[model samples]
Target chain A: MRKIFVCLLVFAVVLSSVALAASSIEVWQIHSPIPEIMNAFDWAAQEFEAETGIKVNMVRIPTEDLHTKLVVSISAGQYPDLLIWNIRPGLEFQGLGVVEEVSSVIDEVGRDNFPTATLTMFQAPLGKQWEIPLFARLAGYHYWKDWLLDAGLDPNPTVLDDGSMVVNAYNTWDDVLETSKKLTKDLSGDGTIDQYGAGFQYNRKGFGDSAAYAFSVITTFGGHLFDSQTGEVVINSPQTVAAYQFMKDIYKSGVMPPGVVAWDGYDNNKYFMDRTVGFIVNSNSVISNVRENDPELADKIGVTIAPAHPETGLRTYSGSPDTMTIFKTDNTDSAKEFAKFLLKANTQVEMFKIMGVGYYGPLLLNVMADPFFSEIGEQERMFVENNKYFVGPEYPGVPSPELITVALAVYNGFVYDDALTRISVDDWSPEDAVKEIEKRVLEMLEER
Target chain B: MENHGGPRLTMMQKETRLGALLLMPAIIVMLIVIAYPFIYSIIISFLRWHAVYPDHPWVGFTNYIKVITDSRFPITLRNTAIYALVGTAGKMIIGMILALILNKQFWGRGVVRGLFILPWIIPMVSAATTWRWMFAEDGVVNFLLQRLNIISQPIIFLGDKQWALAAVLVVGIWKGYPLFMTMILAGLQNIPGELYEAAEVDGANGLQKFFYITIPSLRYVLITAIILSVIWTFNAFNVVWLMTKGGPSNSTHILNTLAYEYGFVGMRYDYAAALAVMTLAILAVFLYFFAKLQKVEE
Candidate 1:
C-alpha cells in the first residue's frame, strides 16, 4: 500500500509538471507591413514571455489577406489565442463567438485610460468588449503645396498648433472639383496634361478603402448606408444619388487621370509621391513617405480635413480602427494576462512612438498625454484633429454586427464604387446605378 | 518464413501483385491529399456554414440554390465563359501563327524563339504587375500613343468596365501563347517532310501545304493544348486578381476570385464551396467532351 501511494504521487507530480511546461499562447497580428511594427510586436512578445514564463508564438499575416486567413483558420478549428486586425470585423467575429469577452482585461488595464468612443464601440450585443483598441487610423485629405501654389491657389486653408485644420480654400465638393480642374494643366502645348488635379482611386480591390472613400463622400452628402437598427438599405437615397452624380461629374470632368477608374488603394499614394497629382485624400502616410524619401518635398506638403459636401455643409471621413481580439482559447488566463500587458498605457505608447504618425495614432486619449502627440509636427497634428470625427459607414454611430455586415457587404462587393464607376465610365445614369446598388445591398442584407 | 520462394503463383500474377504494391503509396497519398479535400468540399457544399459559427447545419441543396440564385452568379458565369473562350481561342491562333513563322529555316530562329518564351518564363505575378503598369492611364502605352497622336486623351485600359476583361485577356494571351507556340512548333517539326515535299511538287502554295499537312499533323497537339489552356485560363486567379481584382464593377470576376470573395471576405464558406463545386463540375464536363473528341479523332 505504501509503494502504490508513492507511485501515484509521482505520476500526479509528473503530469502537473508537464501541464505547466505546456502553458503557451499563440497570436496572429496583422499590422502595417513595416519592420518597425513587426519588431515592436516581437519585442512585446519576448518581454511578455520573459515576464510571465509563458511561451509566445507570434504570426504576421499581411493585412489584405487577414480576413480570409482568419476565417479559414477558425473554420479549420485552428483558432489563434489572439487576433489583431481592424475594428470592422470585430462584431462579425464576436457574433460567431470566436472572440473572448475582454471586459475583465479592460478593467485590469484601467478602462478610463482608453478612449470612450473605442470602449463604446467594442461593448455591444451582450455588453461584452469583443475587441480592444490597439491604435486608430484617421482618414482625411493631404495635398501638394507646390502644385497648389503653382495653380495660383493657396494651399494652407487653416493651420492649427493643436494638430487641427479648418480648410477655407476648398470648403465644399464644388470648390474641390473646380480646384482640381484648375490644377490640371497642359504644359509644353502638349495635348496630354502633365499633372492631374485630384487622384481618386475607384478600383475595388483592397481592404475597403474604395468603399470608405465612397462612404466619406456619401455621408458628407447627407446619405447613410443603412438604417442601422433595421439594417434596411438606404444606399439609394437622394443624397446618395447626388453623391454618385457628383462623382460621375468629377470622373467626366478630366480633372482626374484617365486611369483613375483602375487605381487601387495604393495608386493614389503612388501618384502623390510621384508628384503627378495635386491633391489626394488619404491618411498621413503620404506625408510620411515624402518625409522619408524627400524631406524637401515633405515641407511642400499640406494636410487638411476632407472637404465637406457642397450643399449640406457636413464633413465626414472613414476610419479603420486597429483592434486586438482575444480568441476563445484553452489558455484563457494567459490570453487575458497578455491582453492586459499589451494594453497598459505605457506599453502602447512606447509602440506608438516607435511606429510614428505614419503608421498609427493613439486610440486612447490618455496616451496623447504621453508626449507622443505633444512632440508632433504639423502633419501629425492634422491627423490628431481628424480622428475626432472619423467613423465607419454606420456613422452617427450605432455599432452592431448587422451594421458592420452591411458596410462589409458594400465594401467587399465594391457596390458604391461600382455604381460610381458605372455612372462615370459606362455612361449609366446615376439613378440607375443607385437603383442597382440598392437592389444588391438589400439582397445581401436579406440573405444574411 | 511464410512462403520461401514458393512458385504457388503464376509469373504474370506475381508481376501484377508487384505492380500493385509499387503503386500503393502513390494511391494512398492521392487519397489523403486530393480525394479527401475534394470529397470534403462536396460535403461542405451541402451545408450552411460560416467559418466562425459552431454549427454547420446540413441544408441539403439549399447552399446550391443560394449560389445559383445569387445575382452575381450569372454575371460571374458569363465573365468566366468569355475569359476562357476568348483566352483559349486567342492563344491558339497566335500560337499557330508564331509556330508557322518559327518553323521556317531562318538564321536566328532559335534566338527569336528564346525571345518569345520570355513572357512564359517570367513569373505570372510579375508579368501581370508589369502589364497593369503598362495599361495604367499615364503608362507607356498611352505615352507612346499620345506622342504619336493616336488619341487626344489617355485610355484607362483596366478601369473601364467594357475594356477591363479585354485588358486582362491581352495579358493572359501574352503569358500563355508561348506554351501553345512551343507545342505546335514541336508538332510542326514532326510532320513528314515527304508529305510537304510532295505537296510542293504538286505546286501547292504555302497556304495549301499548311492546310493539307501542317494542321492535320498538329491536330492532336492543338486539341490537347487547347484543352489544357482552357482549364488553366478558366481557373486563373492571380493575373485577374492582381490586375483588376474583379473590379470597376465586379465585371472581371471569374470563378476563382469570386470563390475567394465569398469564402474569405464574406466568410460564407458554404456558398463558396457550392460555387467551387459547380465550377469543378463545369470543367469536368468540358474535359469529358474534349477528351472524348481526342479519342474519337485518334
Candidate 2:
C-alpha cells in the first residue's frame, strides 16, 4: 500500500507540472453569419496552436450583442483576453481604459506592411495604438444590373481615373430619384407594386446600415454633424436639412419599400438578395452572401460608389475595419502574440481569400498586390477601387479621440436615423427634424 | 432541566435559533444578489456616470432632473402608460372571456384550452419574431387581409408610426392573456356552486349572475392578476424591442426600451439608473394599492 501511494504521488506531480507549463488564451470574436469566415478563425487558431503550443479558445458572440456582453463582462471582471470587433467600438473601449496599448505588436508586425490610412485611423487622440487593424469593409451602392438594363439605363458604367464611377443616368441624387421612378415597376400587373426601385434603412435602432447611409448622404451634401474644423455641433445646417429632405423625397416618391422605415440593418440586404429592390447601399457582405448562397443572382449584381451630390460634386463612402484588441489581462502577452500572428501577410491573405475579395478589403498594402486581388471579378475590383474614397466615421472631421467620441455619441444616439424618421414617417419638416437632431446631438456631446 | 447547568434554555428559544440558522443562507443570497444591486443602482442614479469614463462624480438630483426635462421623456412616459394600461385591460378582458367560455360544458374543452395557452407557452423571443414577420408588409397577415377584401392596399403594420404601437400591443395582449385565463379559471373552479344556484333561484339573469356573484367571488384573483399583468406589461422589453425596436420615429419607445438605449447604447448609466429607479417607484406605488386590496380581501 505504501509503495502504491508513493507512485501515485509522483504521477500527480508530473501532471501538475504539465498543466503549469501549458498556456491558453481566450478570444471573444464577433460571430460571423458566414460559415467560411467563422471556420477560418477556427483554422487559424489551430494553426497558431500547432506552431506556438499555446491553445486558442474562441468565443463567438453575435454582432448585435457584442457591445452589451463586453460591457457586462468587463464590469464583472470576466472579460476575454482578446476582443475582436469592428472599428467604432475600439475607440470607446480605449476610452474606457479596458484595452492594453499594442504599439509594440504593430512594430513587430512591421508598420510599413499596413496602409497608412488604416494604421493611423486606429491610432487616435493619444498617439498610442490600442488595436491591431485586420480587415476593412468599404460601403458602396449595389444595384441589379439586369434591372438597370431593363429600365433602358447603362448597365455597365465608366470608372473614372480617380476611382469614382460615372453612371450618368444615376450619377447624382436627382438622377437616382428619376431612375428609381423608372425602376419601380408592377412586374405582375396586379396594380400592387412588386419591386421597389430603391432600398434604404431608415430605422433608428442604433448605429447600423441606416446611420452609415445617412452619414454618407450628409457628408456628400457638404454637411457635417459637427464642424469639421472646430468640432462644434452643426447638424442644423442647410446642407443637413437638404440631405434629410432628399431622404424624405425618396420615401415619399414611392421608390423605396414602405416598410423601409422599420427595417433593421440586414433588411435591405434581404431585399436586395430577394430582388425586391433595384438598388441598395450596403457593405459587400450582401454580395458575399449572394455569391455563397445564390451564385446566379451574384452574376447580375453591379457595384459602384454612392451617388454624388450634383451641386457639391462630392461623394463619400464609409469604411469599417475589422480590428483586434488585447484586453488588460494576465494573458496579454499570449493575446498580443495571437494578434501579431493574424497581422502576418500570409495569414491575412489566407483569411481574405477564404472570406472572398469584396467581403473584406486588405488592410496591408502588400496584400493588395496578391494574385487573388488581381484575378478578382469586376464587382470585386470596383469594391476594392472604391476604397480610395472610403472615410472613417468622423468623415468631415479629422479622426481624433474628441471627434470620435462625438461621432460615437451621434451614432449611439441614432441622431441621423431619428432625424430621417421624423421627416419621412412623422412628416416633420426637414429643418425642424434637423433642429431637433441638433439639440439631441448637443445634449449627447455635452454628456460626453 | 439539568441541575448541573446555571440555567436551562427554553424549547421555543432552541426552535427560534434553528429557524434563524436555516434562514441565514437565503437571507445572505438575497442581500448579495438583490439588495446589493438595487442599492448600487440607486446610488449610481445620483451620480454622473458614463460607463466609458473613469470618473463618476456625484451630481445629486441632476440626473433625475435631466430625465424629467428631456424631450423624449414625456413621449416615453406616455407610451409606457398606454402600453401598460391598454395592454393590461385587453389581456384581462380576453382572459375573462376565454375563461368564462372554457368553464362551461363545451366540446373539446381541453384541446381548446391547450390551443389558447400556446401564445403563453411559446418562447417570448420566438413569439415576437413570428409576430414581427406576420406584421411585415408582404407577410401572411397582409396577404390574408388583402385576400379578404378588407382593404386594397396592404397595411404596413409594424412600419407605419401610426400603427406600430398598436401592433406591439396586439402581440403583448396575445402573449399575456393566458396567465390571467389560467388564474381566473382556477378561481372559477374554487367558487362554491351554491352562490350561482342561489342567484338563479332569485331570477338573476346571466349578466346579473356574472356581475353580482361571479365577479365578487373571483375579486381577489382578478386583482392579483391585474397587478401582475400591469407590472409584466410595463416591464416588457422583448416584444416591443424585437418587433419595432421603439422605432419608426421613436413612436413606440416605452420606458424600459428607452432606459436600455440610454444604458447600453449611449453608455449613460446614470440616466439609465434614474429611469430604472423611477420605474421601480411607479411600480411600488401600484403594488402598494395591490397590497391594500389583498389586505381588504383578507
Candidate 3:
C-alpha cells in the first residue's frame, strides 16, 4: 500500500513538471477600451492555449496611448512578448532592432497568400519580414445619397441597357466642392444654415488622421512626397501647391461646416450621425455606426472612391496595415506560433466579424477570397475593396526606414495640416503655405 | 584632553547617526522618484538618441544649441510667457474675488463652494471636451449669441488664430481658478477676526480694512499659490491640446505642448529633452524671483 501511494505521488510530480516546462508568452494588444474587441482577443487567447498548451498573458492597452507606452517599455527593456500595432511604428521598431524577424513564419504560412503591397509596406529595409499584417483599413469618402439627390447630383445611376444600379463616383475635386456647396442649405429659409456640405476633419491634431487627409490630397494632386531613392522631400512642386490651393478653396468656399478647425476624430462621426453634414471622409467606422443606429439613413448612404485632383486626375488614399510583431527579447518561438495562429485565414475572418459589425478587413489573399468576406454584407465588401487598393506612403516612394521616420515626423508635427489650415482659415497664400510646409519638411528630413 | 572644543559628545553624534539612518529610506525614495529621472533627463538632453534606439551618442551642447537656435523655440517661449502670466494673473484675481464672496456668511455657502470645486474635480479630458463643444460655431455659445443678436454670423472661436489662444486660456482659467479660490478661502478663514475688529475701531473703511488686514494676512498664501499656479499653468498641456492643439498656424502652442509634439509625436527624444531642459531653466528664473518674494514675506 505504501509503495502504491508513493508511485502515484511520483506520477503527479512528473505531470506538474511537464506543465511547468511548457512555454508561456505575454501578448500586448492595443484594442482594449472596446469590450467587443477585447472579448475577441480573450477568446483567441483561450483557443490558442487550448490548442498549443502554452499560456498567454494577454495585456490590453488603449490604441491611442500604446505607441508612447511601447517605446518607454522598449527603452526600459521591458517590451511585451508580442506587440500588435499599426505598421509605421512596427517599421520604427524594426529600425531599432527591438522587434524580431519573422521571415520564417511568413514563409511557413506561405507569403503568397498575402498581398504584395501589404507585405512591401511592412517589410524591413533589408527585405526581412519583421511583422505580419493582420488587417488593413482605407480612408475614403461616404455621403448621403439623398443629399446628392437633393443637390441634383446623380449619386446612383441606372445602366442604359439593363436596370442595374451603379454608384456614380466623384470624378474631380471641383465636383465634390460643387456638390457640397449645393448640399449646404437653410431648411427653414431663415438665412441660417441647418446643414453643411462636407465634413472633412480640419483640426490640426491626431497623429495620423489629419495628416493622412493632407497627404492624400497631395497624392491626388500628383505631388510626390519624396524621391523613392534620393530620400528628398519634393513638396515644392506645382502639383503640391495646387493641392494646398484646392484645400484652401474648399475651406474658403464655405462648403465645409463652420468651426471645422475644432473638429477631432470623432467630431465628423458625430456630425454625420447628427444629420448635419452631407459627406465625410473617414474609415468605414462611420458607416458601421450609421448602420447600427440609423439603418434607414444607412440605406441612403453611398460609398465612393475619394475625389481626384482636377488637373492631374489622380487619387491616392492612405492606409496602414495592422500588424503584430514579436519582440527580440520575447520567447520568439511561442510568440511566432501564436502570431501565426492569429493570422490563420479562418481565425482572422472570425475575429474580424466580431461584435455584429466588422471594422477590420483582412489582408491575406486567401482570406480575401473567402466566401465569408463576400457574404458578410455590402459594407464589408466595399470596405475590403477600398483597403485592398489603398496606397500608403510606401507607394511612389521607397519603403525605407528613413521614409517612414520622416512620414511619422511629418504627421506628428502636423506640418502640412498646419500650413493648409493657415491657407484655408488664416488666409495665407497657397504658395506661401507650400513654401512653409517645404521648409518644415526639409528641416524634419534633415533632423531625422 | 578637555573635549570642550566640540563637546566630544558621542551621545549626540549617535543620535545624529540614528536620525540620518531614519531619513535614509525617505531620501532614497525621493532620489528614485524625483532626482533620478530629473538627472537622467538632463543627461539625455546632451545625447543625440531616439527613445527606442540603443546607440545613444554623447552630443554635449549640440542638442542645447539646436533647440535654442531653432526659430520655434523663441515663439514657444513667448507663448509660454503669455500663457503663464495671463493664466496666473487671471486665476489670482478671480479666485480672490470668489474667495472673498464665499468668505462672507451667505445662503447655501457650502453648496456654492462644492459647486465651485466641481470644475476642478471633473476629469480634464471631460472638461476640455465640454468646453470644446460649447465653443463650437454651431454650439451653445453661438446659439446664445445669435439669440441675443450679438453678431450676424457664428464666430469660430477655436478655428480662428486670433481667438484660439484666448479660447484655450479661458478654459484654463475656468478649470484652474478653483484651486486658487479654495486655497485663498482657507487662508481667509485662518485670519483672526481681531485684526478686522481693530481696524474697524481705528475707523478703517471696508476697502481699507481689506487692504490692511486681509491682504497682509494672505500674503504668504498668495505668494505660494501664485508660484505653484504659475508652474502648473506653464506646464499645462490638456486644455490647449484638447481645445486648439496649437492650431491655425501654430498660434497656440506653449512650451510643454511643443515638447510633446517633438518628443512623442516626432520621435525626437533628444530634442524633446533639450526643450524640457530649457523649460526648467526658465522656470528656475521664475522660481528665483518667487523665492525672493517668499523670503521678504518671511
Candidate 4:
C-alpha cells in the first residue's frame, strides 16, 4: 500500500512536469470557478505565451475560499505569481503585506497614464503600487432601453445628426428613482405589484457596501462617515442624520419593495434581470449575466452612471479593483517582469478583450481615450467622466470595516421586520452606531 | 523468561512490556493530534498575530476582555448555550426512546437498527450540504410543507433569523441522535436477559423496570455520549458556516465562527484568540459538569 501510494505520487508529479515542459515559466493565476474566469486566464495565458516565452497555469478556487487559501499559502512561504479575486481589491487583500508594493511599477507605468481617481484607491493604506490595475466597476444598475423605448421612452438619448428624444443615462440617484417609478406598474390585475421600482442590498453579504452607499447619500445631503482630519464617526452630524432619516422616509414612501433589508447583493441583480425590479445597485458586470440568459434584455439594456445625490452631487460609487500582486518567490525576477508586463497598456487593454466588458473599465487615461475602444466602453466611460474628482474611501483601521458593516446593517435593519436580520445588524441609532464605530476604530488604532 | 520457541518467558512481565509498547503509539498520536492544537490555541488565546504574518505578540488579558465585552459575545454565548441545552436534552430523550424500541426482539430488528444509524454515517459536509439544499427557498422542506398544505408561502429557513438557528438545531439533532442511540444500544445489549426476567417476576411494571434497571445500566454510556456531543457540537463550524454563515445578519454566529472571522477574515488575531480562550473557558465549565456526572454515574 505504501509503495503504491509513493508510486502514484511520483507518477502524478512526472505527468505534471511533462505537461508543463521546461522552457515555459508557469504563471499561477488565481480566480473563481466560473467558466468566464477560466476563459480570462486561458486567454491571458495563451496570448502571453504567443507573445512571450511563458506558460500561465490557472488555479481555480471558489471565490469565498480564495482568501483563506492565499493567506495560508502566503504565510507558509508559498504564493502564487498573480491573484485576481472576486472581492473588491482593497478590502480583502491589498492593505496586508501579502500584496506587493506596486509604487515603483506605477512610477514606471507613469502617473499620467493611469487615472488620477483610480490612483487614489491605491494611495497609502489601500495605497502603494502592489496591484497592476486589471479592471474596475461603478456600483449601479443596467436598464433595458429597448423595454423603455417600447414603453415610449426613446432608446438612445444621445442624438446623431437627426434629432430624437432617446433613453439617456441617469446622472444622479433621484433620476434613477424617478425613472423606476415611471417604469414600474402592475402588468397583471392581481393587485400585487409584479413590477417594482427599485431595491437595495441590506442583507449579510450585500451589507458590505452599505457604508459607501449610505454615506454617499449622506454626501448627497453633505455627510461623511468620518471627519477626514479629526478621525471621528460623524453619523450623528446633521448632514448624515438628515441622510439617515431621509432613507427611512424613502422606505416609508414605498418607492422600493417590501423587505429591502433582507435582500442580498445578488438578489437585486436577479430582480432586475427578471424585469420585476426597475432599478438596483449591483455589479456592473451583471449586464453579461442578463445578456447570457435573457438575450432580449441585452438589446434593450442601456448601461449608465447611477443618479448623483440631489444636493452635494457626490457620485459615490463602490468598486472592487481586480489586483495582481507579484510575491517574492524563488522566481522574483520573473515576477517583477510579469508585474511590469501586466501594467503595460497593451496587456491591460488585452484583459478587456479576453475578460469581456461592462463589469469594469481600465484605470488608464491613455486606454480610456483610445478611439478604437470608444464604442465598447460606454457606461464606464460615463462613470469616469462623472466622478472625475473621485477618491477611494479608506478604512480607518481593522475594526473600522466591521463597525461600518455593523452600522450599515443597522441602517438596513430599520427596513427588515425579522429578528434574525435585525440581530446581525446593530439596531443602534446613527448616533449610537457612530459612537460604537468611533470606539471600535480607536481599539483598532491601538491594535498591532 | 521468553515465549515458546524463542526465549523462555514469564507471562506477566512480557504481557506488561507488550501492552506498554503497543499503547505508546496511541499516546503519541493523541498528544500530537489533540494536545498540540489545544496548547497552541491556549498560547494564541493570549497572543496577537497578524493574519499575514504568523509571529504573534502576546497581549495577556486584553483578548479575554474584548471577548467578554463585545455585544455579539453575549449573544453568541447565549446561542451556544441554548443549542447545547436543547440539543443534549433532545438527543438523550430521543435516543433513549429509540434504544427502548430497538430493545424489543422482533423480525427485521437488525435492519431497523442499521437504518437508524444512517444519519450518523453521513459525512458532515455532505449532510450539511443536503440540509442547506432542503432549506433553500424552493428546496424540499418547504415543498413538503406545501404538499401537506401546512403553509402557502415558501419559508426562507436559513434566510430568517428566528427560523435559522432552529434549522441548525433540526440538522444537529438529526446528526447527533444516532451517536447516543448506538452507545446506549450497546449498553442495553450488555445486560443479561436473566436480570430483566427477574425484574418481570418481581411484578414491576415496564416504567418501573426502565427506571430501576435500564436507566441504571445506561448511566455511564449516557454521560460519555453527552460530554462528547457537547464538545463536537460546540466546535462544529462547517455546518453553521456552510448553512447561513451565521446570518440573516450575524444572528447565528457562535464563538467558533467569530474566531474564524476575526482571525482569518477580519485580521484581528488577538481578538480571535481572546475569543478562543473564552470558548475554552466556557467548555471547561461543561467539562466540570461532565466529570461530576461521571462520578455520579459511577
Instruction: Give the per-residue lDDT digits (tens) of candidate 4, residues B87-138.
Output: 8778888888898899889999999999889998999878977887687555
lDDT of 4 at A163: 35
Clashing pairs in model 1, backbone N/Cα/C closer than 3 A: A163-A381
Q: What is candidate 3's CA lDDT for residue B167?
A: 85
Candidate 3 residue lDDT tens string, A156-257: 633323332234545567878888888888898998888888877665754456677777788888876787787677878998888888888888888778
Model 4 per-residue lDDT tens digits across residues A128-159? 45455555544444566655665666545463
The model with the greatest DockQ is 2
Residue B213's lDDT in candidate 2: 84
Give each prediction's DockQ, rounded to 2 decimals: 0.57, 0.65, 0.55, 0.22
- Model 2 chain B worst lDDT run, 10 consecutive residues: B1-10
Candidate 2: tens digits of C-alpha lDDT, residues B1-298? 4599567779998899999999999999999999999999999999999877888999999989988997778989999999999999999999999999999998899999999999999998889878877887888899999999997898888779789999999999999999999999999999899998998999999999999988998998998899888898778899998888788777889999989988887888899999999999998998998798789868
RMSD of 3: 4.6
Point out the worst 10-residue segment of candidate 1 chain B by lDDT: B48-57
| DockQ (0 to 1) for model 2 | 0.65
Ranking by lDDT: 2, 1, 3, 4
> How much lDDT does candidate 2 score?
0.83
lDDT of 2 at B44: 94
Docking class for candidate 2: medium
Better of 1 and 3 by DockQ: 1
